[model samples]
Target: MRTLTVFALMAVVLGGSGRAAEVVVPADMSCRTEGFGYADTNRHDSSKLSVRASSNGNKSWIKFDQLGDYDLSKLRAATLTVFLHEGKSGSQQCDVSAVNDDVTENIKWVDHPNQENPAEEIYALTWNNAPGNLTSDMGLLDAAKTTYIDTITFTDGVEGQGFEVEVLDILLADTDGIVQFVLHNSPNLLNFATHDNPTEAKQPYLTLRFAPEGADHPVPEDGAEVDTTLAQLAWTNPEPNTPGEPIYCDVYLGADPNRLLMDKVEVGPDVSGVAINTDNFPNFGLLANKVTYYWVVDCYDTDKGLIKGEFWSFYTNDNLPPEVDAGADQVVWLGMGEDPNQVTTTLSGVTSDDGLPGPYTVLWTQEVNDAPAVVIVNADQDVATVTFSERGVYEFTLTADDGDKQTSDTVQVIVGDSPCDASHMSTGEPYHPADANQDCIVDLADFVLLLAEDWLACTDTLTQCGMLLPM
Candidate 1:
């Protein structure tokens, strides 16, 4: 188990001097456990978060989503700040621990009184009645052990006291893009403002500080047009990661600027280039032929600090030809029943384009394979009709033109004198339409079987007497 030591805890004023890269993210979800009025009821919408012990214990949990926005690898300090709405504590100690799962807002005290059943005691903070400052180091359990940093002292019991605790180790070890903490005080009753607090500024939040920044000049440049096959991305890192000081670069790429959840690439120290291919973009797929791609880079230096890069965009070339599918290879017979040689089949072709240079054109032409030549109506359209003059095999080609490029596909059409002539065989393999008995032959035996199976199976309501009316 990896453990993180809580180095310090201070009961400082809420407002303080801010850092350049400091980010204050409020808890998006929060809930408190009620043990007195309703132990099983969820207080997610409650404006106050209460923590107490005794028999009617009350605990609170706060959760923050999208932790990926901050670089945890280069996190220098993470302070959990909460506004004490109503509470007076002289020597009471409150502890905060990490939970295994992201607890929903509908959490109840009856679910787990002590903490969430799966909650892990990652870290805790203790404060005494002594004035000034105190240095208290405590260990918290996780995958590893814990260590303490500073001490927190609560002199006179008073309302509206803001508490700040360092929780760097907890945030650093989080794998999922979520940060959740549970607050518990066994002896003292304390109430804090929650995310639903009337005053938004008094709500609980986390302030994060990351490493320094770095200058990056991306290859191919931003907004440059490049080939579709370009697979590598290079950058000039003014401060490269050395052997002792490792750095990671997270690359986010997508067409939509809002949903750029691309993969992150961890580059070794001294390396300044990374490959941009399908292996990195599992959800985004491959680079399209003609598209304007947007990408951002965030680097985390183990020594100097972490810095996020600006958004860069480049357009891919669009000279590729259109794709086409000439439907499935068709199998048609001469004619149904009465007409044995007047077969007219419609040919449907599908085409796809990138809309690059402009619009495209489509045409369907007959290929001379085995035939006495066929007549095609509307040969310049994707859907055309072809009439067969003789019984043989034929092919129709559908070609698409985009002014600069042309692509074509062909479909085969087989025509015969009768249903048996075009498809029947002695091998009993290929489908034969006239083979009613399924013997692969169109003989008198098939007709006898058909009559015996469907002798008087007609669904005509008006002809109950079995007399047919002329239409």
Candidate 2:
């Protein structure tokens, strides 16, 4: 149905001459299709990128720099992918180019070999851009109908907001050939220190130096106390704190922080203090119980970039245990067991947790020898003396409530004596001192009391057991 063709030209777009200018083309602007192009999936295999394009088309330009915002030195590499379908071109013919700020040998270019027939291709902007630099990888594929992935790394040039890339010099035979280009933000591991050929190019395209005038980008630590992991750690507070400013707070975590991360946790504009579990609250949770952890801090200006403070590394924590200064508490007691009378006892302590000792209620109850004892205390009293009158034993206990949890304690007391004294009176004979009724003497040696015959038939009614006083 659709057709495809290889492109003709490729260009590197560069920005103006600032520490932030951009370049559209690379070292040598040229296309090489002999043994280069995207991988099996129509994108780059080695570089970190992937792209897609329209089908069956040609005679167009691929720009690497459109609204160039960065310099060339910041860039690491570039690439282009080509897709081939039904087409008219019997072979491939195209050029890829790159340019640096160097005024001398500023531009680099390459072309693809002619083919008896047409096929899909993938391309890259790599070492080949330089005269003596390796040409193993360069432009390899057509953008139309092909997914092209390009990884471009500039010396000091990179993307921020409102940045653009340009690609041109395209020639495709596919009537429907389309070009899709994408940029990757992956790092160039092996080329972190790669620099442009100062002698070859009079005007270098870009230039960006690392921090500390010599050190590389600072490493981020997880244990560090921060307001947030966001690229920009800005603080905002609509209402002020003790100082009166709307947002006055500090981020505290570890000891001196510069050598490990940055700042003293005393950030500004808004971050000075925070409650528990608040988001970006200094970007880190405070370790409980003085559990030391890492921490850092930084500042930002509307005009000046991030003012990264010296990275400090240490172990320090600021956690306190639960406050035990419970306010008011109370207790009331309810008597238990066969006692014909019921009584309630109560006592009140300082307010459980109101920060002020006051009228408080204490509620508690427990089981003693099969009897349930109940108690309740109100805010009117400060102390209660527990007392019991029954023959049973008793235990005095107290309970109170905290904001999230409750607490209690206990004290023991002894009550009533043996209800089992009858067991010691058992005698050997059923007739003698066992007067059965225990009158301190034996009387019914088999004859004693009498009962109505109507009720005496059961168990052959023993004399002493059946005697009933005349009612």
Candidate 3:
């Protein structure tokens, strides 16, 4: 028959304690002997094996091949199973011992070396009946011969009952990879299915449980470049041989690869993915336009503990928009035949683009309003000129663009009534047709101004009086 020993590596400890793994080894060789030194008589198929202890000491020996690769020092827990087929008598106490002799499948019952002085007693248990006498050592065997690890008690003679024994420490101390065990009941006769049984499913086997392995399959693909500031991180859970165990993941993120600045998210064991954005972390703040970020996912189980993953990184895209800052508002007064250059307001502001190369494009646009304003823009330049035709308020906007993105800012202009209007003075003044000086008196001072500037040919009323009105 073929020998089977399966080794599976589980969790890997990143920065903390080491991880654990599991191994399964099935019995490769087994034989049973009758009382009075009888050799192999029953050539049973691979369906069942038997053991008994009466006047002459009925015993069975089982051994596994090639198991030395497992590091006994790293072992946490282990179990050995013996599948019971049937029993002849009532409750029975069984003695389990480790075989120190070199044995193989070819050996017969009479050829077994340990038949005279059986190997060291490692474990003992009761089997085949309810509330069996577990305290009894049958007086036929001595206790001080070897160390005993643990014991098991059987409640019934039911078929297919697995009598399990813990042998973690015993296996660790064993130098040779060969696993040979001897089973004999001192009080009653017990029968069990062995590796020779035709029903292979009932064969004896051993299982070792340990910590989990490292996480895998990270999103964003390690060192990929992303366009958005918000990123979703994900990874696969470490699979376990013992099913139904809950697994939790802790996500770490930061601009620095070594030190994670983002708040750690305690995700429930049910979820494998998590999202991070500017809203979630205010102090660490939003992800800047063209910055690189590092992240990792640490996986854990309540029983197995923590296993951290390797560090990964991704960069953000750099085609960001420019920022615009329109200069402050301005106010102006009206005058007759006024040259726009004399009262023109400089419409200017600052702009910046953190994206790529060189100077960005700048534009100034005049917004249409109810106010009579003659707006002119030097669209090519960062600063421009704007003039008002009449007394009213005007609004202008400045926009900056960096090919991929654009932004704008607004500024207001207030144009008040001409300051030379004597008729509209706040003070209660009597208006005169020749009030050129607007002194509320309309006297000879106004007349002298009009006469010196050609009063006779002046057709316009305000111009004839030497009074200038806003153009």
Off by over 4 Å in 3: 1-20, 37-46, 87-90, 100-147, 211-471
Residues 107-149, model 3: lDDT tens digits = 2222223332324332111121101112233212223333343
Q: Which stretches of candidate 1 lie over 4 Å from their true place?
A: 1-20, 101-153, 215-471
Q: Which residues of candidate 2, in runs, are more than 4 Å off? A: 1-361, 367-371, 374-389, 417-471
**What tens-digit string does per-residue lDDT give for candidate 2 at 85-161?**
11222222222222212211212121222311223322333322222222232232323223332233223321120
Q: Which order, best to worst by lDDT?
A: 1, 3, 2
User: How well is each residue in 1-471 modelled by candidate 1, as lDDT tens digits?
Assistant: 222222222323233211225677787766666454454454454567776665566666677776877778877778787766665646655666655433322222221223444354321111111011011211122322222323334544344466677888878877766776666643667677787678666677887876435535678687898877777777755464455566667667777654345555566555677677767766554778678887766676676566667667788875778898999876666674346658788888888888758988888888876467777788887788887757777888999898877999999887766666666422235656667766557888877876777777777878755886766
Q: What's the distance in Å from true for residue 8, model 1?
A: 19
Question: For model 1, what is the error of residue 175's alpha carbon versus the real structure, in angstroms, after optimal superposition?
Answer: 1.5
Q: State how far residue 299 of model 3 sits from its true place (Å).
A: 7.2
lDDT values, one for every candidate: 0.63, 0.29, 0.59
Error of 2 at 471 (Å): 56
User: What is the C-alpha local distance difference test score of candidate 2?
Assistant: 0.29
